[model samples]
Target: MLKKVRVQIVTDRFEAKGSLYETPAGKLLPTPLQDMPAKEDIEHMEMTVEASYHDDGDRVCIRYKESELSGMEGSVTSVSFRKSEPALISMLRDGSVKTALVFEPAARHLCVYQTQIMPFEVCIYTRSVKNCIEENGTLEMDYTVELRGAQAEHTAFSMRVLPVFDKPISK
Candidate 1:
């Protein structure tokens, strides 16, 4: 069955400035990273958006859009989760930036990140995945992103899905 749902997402991202010194565009950040103290940045985001949810008793799929609130406007995201000893989760995004990412505990996978200017390969190291979307309507994941062979960022994300219920008629 297909259902309309409200999906709430909270994501925390950490990045190291040293990794930004040289990107595909070249020399994006300050040079002489060794001379300067390693700088790190952390970002937190929370958003609630409408989504479509489908569960066929074996697998669950959720599709939503990246709105201005999430800072990735013009993007459509879909996540497929399968239940197992350790749940398997895969996410695909299409729009300005496109990528298909897989999350499996203690696994490393490479995927190409396509952007407006260019496309490059990135490595994803998944630390953990907790999928409770079927039991408690929640999902959690932790992973590190390596860009150009440099450990650039780590992200911890959690999401909760709530089915949309019809309101009662006012008396």
Candidate 2:
């Protein structure tokens, strides 16, 4: 039977690489494809996680402080992971992998200031869950999110989750 457990996440490293999209007309375009809240924004963030397992998959909801994000919106991120393989799993995020396509008239005279947002299909990968076990032991996993070209960029992060056990009080 699947059970619920409370764990704490120790964020080891979180960062996003900067990218520059060079146009055919030799122009550099920049976007919010970088990680927000700078590295020095937080000394260290440890968020409490509530995870539950179901028949088909498992779900985890994480809550953190808005101060950690600095200027970013929201403080909760829910992650869905499916357990199919014995040693590996995937983290799913739908409609997240998206890109902006420049049409004919738009790309003809496109400038950094005059950029338009368009809907285009971008590929999203279900990153494998590493360093995790199916048993009731210490679970450690690496979260990787790599999406480019005009959407929010979420870099990879590794966290260690240790189940907290409560001790009975003496009567």
Candidate 3:
């Protein structure tokens, strides 16, 4: 059986300015800072994501697109699941799951580290289960996802578990 889960994310934050400094040789240097180039009002943004899982339930495929005014608009991000229990266990034991965020449209130039299941981890968690059975014998599922991200060190963006599902009506 194949399942589809839909997720929506919204965020509002200000953009920071880039730091400028002069070196001892009178050369301008750029620092590695996560803040934006300038301070601005919090902009509202939304993203819609779809995740598909195989019948065996060991693998997952995800696709997401985000809309932002201050940053990259209409950006997309994707990831594939590798069947590695040991890797997952190791990540859990280490209290962090770090992975590069490769969403071409949004984070093309940025490297994102996602930590799945650890506290303050920057990652997304999803679960699906049979919710109800229709009178005509159609089964429905309830899907939930918890998403988290960090624009910079010590700055976190979080989306708590929000439930979205598809209900198959009987004929």
Candidate 4:
């Protein structure tokens, strides 16, 4: 069965304990990454995305207009997400956020990494631990993205999801 879900993502700044630099060396920091003060003005972004979603229990797919702002609104982008560890989904899936992006057309192992905020286009890759909270039949997911290299930007976002269901379509 296919299900409909309402997704709302709101993000502005990334409150980080320290800054991360993505270099040829790898993910690193100037000083000890832990026990540090949170940084400010890391990035500027205020976006609201509303789209149609389909989840087949095992896989989650979403399609929406190409631009949230002014545009022809004729093109749609489809994205799919698969569990990293398929076998232990129920046991270790909660509060775990991994890299997510469109699975086809212009596909890659990770999102097209960018250095600055394009205002209209917010593209950030996140592969980190997620914190989750449950409400009256709703779930909230929170995660962060970091600026890497000299021209990079970052953000921390919270996504609230509410599921909608309909009668199964008869074959």
Candidate 5:
């Protein structure tokens, strides 16, 4: 069944060669900056938007739009996953900027990124993918991008698909 939903997406990104800080356990620490993607070695974004959610058999899908608040005003995004492949997910964005990205653990996908200037081919290497939508209403992915054959950035992306429950009106 398909129903209206509210989707919250949070993305944390870092340059492949960025960061001079690490945790005591030796893990890279996400940089903190006032503005997003501010060339300060790290970027972060969180957005909530209305969407449609559907689940049938073993497949789950969520579709949403990109508003001006997201800087992708006319774009639409669709994300889907299958229960059998819980470690993989597919995302497609159409409109101003169009692209289809497949996220699978330890795999690389070559995709075309369409822009107003021109279309460029980019390479995406997935480090990890966890789809817990059906179980917990969340999906997470980590991946790196290569632009023009050069490593660019790494992004940790997560989203929650929550049902919108309306309150009853008193007559």
Candidate 6:
């Protein structure tokens, strides 16, 4: 049987601003500033995660929805996933592995300007699992998200994972 799951995330938002420049012909050229005037603008973010395993017992499907709230308006950022080896099942069942969750950036969408952008390469890994539970034979895992991108500036954000459950409640 499949169990309905909800994961709650709490995090401290940190912000820092600086400048980047490039030299051409031995002359330094300033790049456009990120201009994040409001410190609250980049402070806090939220994400929703839903995952279910296939009935065939080989593949799993997961989705992530992230939104940032600051200023008077809020925006949704990027959403992605990761994949790992099949050993995750043994780790979870035995409870031997303190952290058994492994994820990869399977798909992602980012809001850029007035349009949404889907970058070709966006990957992430599980930084840590804060909590884990098996209730009514259902397994729930919660952790922190660590973002990774091909570029530096684009890869900066962390969100808490809500308890994501695997379907069929594996024994």
TM-score of each: 0.77, 0.38, 0.31, 0.45, 0.79, 0.28
The better candidate by TM-score, 1 or 6, is 1
| Superposed model 6: Cα runs more than 4 Å off | 10-42, 46-56, 64-114, 117-171
Tens digits of per-residue lDDT for model 5 on 55-161? 78888888899988777889999999887887878888999978788888877777778878888887667777878888888999887676674546778899997
lDDT of each: 0.74, 0.35, 0.30, 0.36, 0.75, 0.28
Candidate 6, lDDT over the whole model: 0.28
Q: What's the candidate order when arranged by decreasing TM-score?
A: 5, 1, 4, 2, 3, 6
Of 2 and 6, the candidate ranking higher by lDDT: 2
Q: Which parts of model 4 are misplaced by more than 4 Å?
A: 14-22, 30-50, 66-79, 84-150, 164-171
97-143: candidate 4 lDDT, tens digit per residue: 22223212111122333223321222233433242312232222222
What is the C-alpha local distance difference test score of candidate 4?
A: 0.36
| Residue 51, model 4, lDDT | 53
RMSD for each of the candidates: 7.6, 11.5, 14.9, 9.3, 7.3, 12.7
Evaluated at residue 141, the lDDT of candidate 5 is: 89
Top candidate (TM-score) = 5
User: Per-residue CA lDDT of candidate 1, range 1-171, in tens?
Assistant: 677788999987766444432433323233223223334455778998888887777777888999987767999999997655436788999997687888888666777778889888877667678888887889999776766866577778999997663232233
Higher-TM-score candidate of 1 and 4: 1
> Residue by residue across 1-171, what tens digits does model 2's lDDT show?
344555555553444343222223433223223344566742354555554433335533222222233222233233333354333333322232222212121122222211134433332222233535445433444322223365323323444444452232233
- Candidate structures ordered by lDDT, highest first: 5, 1, 4, 2, 3, 6
Alpha-carbon lDDT of model 2: 0.35
Off by over 4 Å in 5: 18-40, 149-151, 165-171
Model 1 C-alpha RMSD to native: 7.6
lDDT, residue 58, model 2: 52
